[model samples]
Target: MVERSHKPGPISATTASSLPQAQVNVSDDNSKVTATIPSGDTVEVLLYGATIISWKSNGTENFWVSDAAKLDGSKPVRGGVPVVFPVFGPPPKNHATSSLPQHGFARNSRWEYLGKSTSESASDDSVKMDFGLYSAGLSEEAKKAWPYDFGLVYSVTLTKGELSTILTVRNEGKEGFDFNVLLHTYLRIKDISTTTISGLLGTSYVDKVLDARESTESNSDLRITGETDRVYKSLAQDTTTVVENGSPRFDVVRKNFRDTVIWNPWTEKAKGMGDFEPKTGWREMLCVEVGSVAEWVRVEEGESWEAGQTIKSLV
Candidate 1:
């Protein structure tokens, strides 16, 4: 709900209401809902999270209740909404991104606001915000190191309380490029020990926890009670990572990809996180990343590719 103007001045009051007819406002705080339908029942989105932070109507519900704040510092925040791109996971010691970075460069970079718009949805009110990041704008020195003429655009929209993200990757130049990409999302949960993730059980995965310390072949379903890290490969479209407690279930549906990185660094590992809060934070969140770690996405000259994820609340 924060001001999303690309200009460097005060936010325009008419920005949200000025959108298309399908858009309206159902929010008191400008930092909450951006666009809405005429009925004011459904909201378009919350740009700060590009992240449909929360949505509720007609007895159904959706909300980012966990204190998963946004990542807005040079140092990563202990817990929050962090964007990941360009590369995923730890880079080689001599790699270009080996400079104290985690889950790639997007979260570490600033995204430019393109504009705003509205749409009609079954949920009634749908709003869309476009955000982009590019390699062309980087410094000459930076280009020399990670040479890839790339442009990543994320179109985040909210309708009927569901947050849908459409990611587009373009090879902005006359060259091919490859990189591991992921949306390193940490969704807040009630408790780590009490929460049980379904759908992934019995599925095969490459254990990163053991891989980080030694080399081995891991092909197993991920059910973690403590420290865990793994990338599940060759997953089916219906495949889902469901975090459940009692009756309701929150599903992280992954698509058009071949890797699912499940991570939870408990105890010592939690304390060692770059910006993680060791005191009372580790258990309230779960990192289930939608990624392309099995292989790199290759974009040809002047072409583009797309991938996305949908975070749905089914309580």
Candidate 2:
């Protein structure tokens, strides 16, 4: 059986003392588990509610998750993958009418560490860790919001050179439930301005920054420039995908998620990012998220849904 607990129990509590802590069990295939933070602390980044906080390594910080949240509680102590679910982006003005937390509480709330296993896919090779959150803990909030019992399971595995995430949502209530979700990932980059996303050519996307009002389809490969944010619609069913291209390009293969979000805070917004480093303009990183925002997933009672993304570094 897998050991389970909520919040960074004893280890996470001691991080304030700089004594080095152990929160969630670090596990690998063969059921082996360790209870200490791993080595290599050149720098640290955060994943807050599925948002990238910051990433620093070897004297250079490539990704910007958020610099401001370090003072607030929305930051993650662990420097790797953080899972987001149920909803993404800003909350609707009427959060009371919704059963979701601000970007859902999966990232902020502690998860029950399920266990570990080997990769089941042949193309990918790495260990996998399982984490889960239930609606039971949020029943009071749910009752006031939408009043439905549901369960969410998130799994993160460090494979080869990248982290992979699998999100599963189950409807445990008698009634149906519906909502949007996103894997709001902040990827580390050599340079954001020089990075280009291929494999999306001829694919159509709904430009969010251009206007949340229209669905603009794209057929050409995109290169990041300014504050560009767009939601793609009716995307191809194939899993072949790519995010960054240069000496090293990140290739992403997704399952079940049909929408893609491309975002970068180019000029003024980049400076305003709380946790973001100063003088790091559009040269930092990009946020290319795999999500389903415009579409609402409806899971029936006793039914469950799963979505995931596998990332590979071609660098």
Candidate 3:
């Protein structure tokens, strides 16, 4: 296991022409930026969908990407934290619903690399990077479906024992538009059945497994028995904890995101998925996503909306 250093200091940046140049690597279709803090916690980001594919600290992998996931850009990679924008799940009930694809085009579309920098906060020595996507650069098919002009800037930060992803969306069009977004985070664990999620007590959720029925969570720590798909709407707090066996695992915190989604496909659904390998991959992963789902958020013309989530390891 990699050990995390609690010492305070910033990592030296490589310089070019008296300016600090961020460490980045590009190969073929994907570009990766690695951020290493002074304490040795490291994060690796793939430019494809601004996805965070790897985060290692204290010698353990904190996130999961499917072994059978396609990296050739043919479809959204089945793991990691996929950026779901403009829509979530299936198309909404509307006249123009047929135009938008599942989870919109943010995941499959290529984003422009905006480079990296150090954090401005006095208490932070983390490294941060930015990526952008503009509707003007989208394909004609995507343009025809959602014609509103927009800009999305995704910022990722790697700090000691933590990783943060922030998304900012600007409506450049003349009229206001409404949309939903999510960070579809797939977290790795030793055993899915032994995991318990806390901090959702008294919150009402829509159980997708129960035909989208509304229900309230009464348990302080939720355990998964079978196939589970739930969306906790209008969250009262911004943090949730995932505990494996009797030990704390990860603490997920979010801002400007009103909903939390917990999902585990279990046996039947896992066997039905071609991208999830080994046929028993469901036992090792869980999806604890934080985002603004359940309702559409409206951004006025020339205005922007910001939301973010941070994952901190407890082990």
Candidate 4:
């Protein structure tokens, strides 16, 4: 066995010789699984949508979940990390995803666990769990909405203070298809008003609240004072940070993702949604989502594409 270290995670997949044991807890009904690394970090994933509802690092929850989130598979979970595939937001009128729901069926559809792998190095012990969502496994209603053979492998890796999520999509059909994918990550914070985002100093973005007009960011450290929803593109750096109360809280770095979406519904907008409980939940969360959305990714027959994000805790 590779001896563990007290130092936090470094957030990269590794190949080790011996198979390290994964500390896991699975629900009796198979709805969720909670896996832990040897260094005391844990991650909880639900089978429905293969969504991660909880990721705890050093006993603190990094991802946020709404108090009114529906976990019974009756509807999509309101918060945390919800996988968006095949489409993002509303569908265009004359498109293959026209008949699909707002963010496609990936978040509402149930997924299957493909199992887990654990490895240990001198630095820490890491566990990577996989989930599968195949076209044949989707509901008939979803199939009829957008018919195309595909396979999605969602992997979650945990090592101390970092949680990395990766998705690999393969086209399993005879013909090529176009799709868009994203991970809607709701990062919990001490307070939204105190949170500031750096590294987007001069990036251009599409302000969705302002009728989706193209705009340029002028702030050196962006702060949210009102309802905000903007899609930032062509970022100067691949690594960005979330600073709360003048302290660096989280560092987010992505691979193969070309766009970053920053969002917070604030007061009036939060009150408008029925699922947004407490009416003040917006003050405790900030969404820094990364994905490929400026243009659709086309996967030819027998071809595959992949993208992912890694979050490091700075607390």
Candidate 5:
């Protein structure tokens, strides 16, 4: 029931040239672009959604993708860091994207590979690339759902011990538009029950699991038990930490993104997802997304907005 994008052939030398001296490899099916670092860290990106399908540190994968994930672009891959734009969950009441998909057309549409770059500084050596989608490249269905000229540029950077993503949106139309966006990150964990998220204390959030009720987080550390879906708004801090078994795992930092979405399908909801591996998949992954979703961003003509998130390992 999902729409698929056209698959390209393997990346050629000319395509690899965009990355300069970095080690760039294309997927066998030519749907992905992978950049590897000398320190054994690597990042794989799918052109379909500019999705970060994999990120490995010291040969250990930090991201999770469902075993039953549709890499052929049939639907948005069920894992990794998916770029959500224009709208977050459902469309705002009577909004332009009301007729579009749940997260809008950005994740579902194919993006054009812009280029890649490598930066060397005193402390870090990183490889980064840009993938873009414009109103002209959007599908007819998407154009009809929200007819406005727009441009989106997504940048993925991989450093020695960190992965960063920056998303910038430009309004090219004659009028302004309002929208929401997020980085729907599915982080891999050793065990979901043993995981605890901190730094959201006193932050007000919308509890999606309990009929979208609003509540304040009084607990210093939040643990998962059942199906959990909450959107923490107007964070007092810019960073949050994820710990497992009393050991810090990773730190998530956000810039210009005011909200954080925490989700876990748990048991019953996980059973209904066809793209997710049924039995044990939910136990291996948790979603701790960061973005500007609680409120809408209004962009006027020829204006732009940028938001970013960086994930660093604490181990």
Candidate 6:
């Protein structure tokens, strides 16, 4: 059985020497970093994909990871927030990203932790950490697949009340590169049947599961009952909320992210995937991804682009 945990706080504690002042800890194996605040909230990120494996707030885990997720750097981490870059899904023939694999190489490539910036005060207790991935650091195999010198700086900030993820892409070579980025975030909830999405009324979307056709939404709040794979484009607003029962549980606030993807594998699709353990796990997790996926963002030589989203746990 694939069991899920609604565990409170982090299972791993921060290192002893770094706690009193910064409340941040790096794993002994140098594989992951965990940051905690005095309020007992914590977040853990693996350097493998710079994937956020766990994030806890309001004394509950806000992100979901599969019970059988691979953590040995074998493949892309099964859940949490996985960074999709250069390509979103399959690559089109003859396109710049055609030479790359699905979802590009960012999630599978190793990243470097560039350290954290201090910002603790009597009124504010937000911690920010940055990770970097550059063309020069990629493996030769990855370089041969899609050769373009670029730099990616990903920042994760844990505020007293919410969590924010920001990304910056810089062209480091004389040649330009076209890319797409998506923060594939999986949110944990009590029940999919009772959960509803708000703030996407009248927005047009492409139904990936339904012949990839376009249609407009008519509801201000929508519920998911079965398999759903939709790419909501040109969102009417920047904020999307997950409502459970009659109360709001989480608010997804985005910045410069032109698209929102609401997806759930549901029953049948969930069982077909090798990584989605505890097949029934789909009942408790929903993917609300944000990115610039409707069209590719072309970075000119010596130029850069930026975008991000902030998820607030209202519960």
How close is every model to the real structure, measured as TM-score? 0.73, 0.72, 0.89, 0.92, 0.91, 0.93
lDDT values, one for every candidate: 0.60, 0.58, 0.85, 0.91, 0.89, 0.90
- Across 215-265, the per-residue lDDT of candidate 3 in tens digits comes to 999999999889999999998989999999978899999888999999989
Query: Whole-model lDDT, candidate 5?
Result: 0.89
> Which pairs clash in model 5?
none
153-237: candidate 1 lDDT, tens digit per residue? 8876655535567789898887787767776666666677776665564455776677644223332333457787877666655
Report model 4's TM-score to 2 decimal places.
0.92
lDDT of 6 by residue, 189-247 (tens): 89999999998899999999999999998888899989999999978699999999979
Clash count list over all predictions? 7, 12, 3, 0, 0, 0
Q: In candidate 4, what residue range of length 10 has the lowest lDDT sum?
A: 13-22
Worst 10 residues of 5 by lDDT: 13-22
Candidate 1 lDDT? 0.60
TM-score of 6: 0.93
Which of the two, 2 or 6, has more lDDT? 6
**Model 2 alpha-carbon drift over 4 Å, by segment:** 1-82, 92-102, 119-125, 139-143, 215-219, 237-248, 279-282
Model 2 residue 300 distance off true place after TM-score fit, in angstroms: 0.8
Lowest summed lDDT window (length 10), candidate 3: 16-25
41 Cα displacement, candidate 4 (Å): 1.0
For model 6, the stretches where C-alpha displacement exceeds 4 angstroms are 1-20
* Candidate 5 C-alpha lDDT tens digits along 1-315: 765587677776644335334577776877899998767689999988888899999778899899988877789989999889889987767777798889988887888888888875435668898899999999898999999999999999999889999999999999999999999999999999899999999999999989999999998999989899999999999999999999989899998999999999988888888888855788988899999999889999999999999999776
| Candidate 5 displacement at residue 89 in angstroms | 1.3
What range of 10 consecutive residues in model 6 has the weakest lDDT sum?
Answer: 13-22
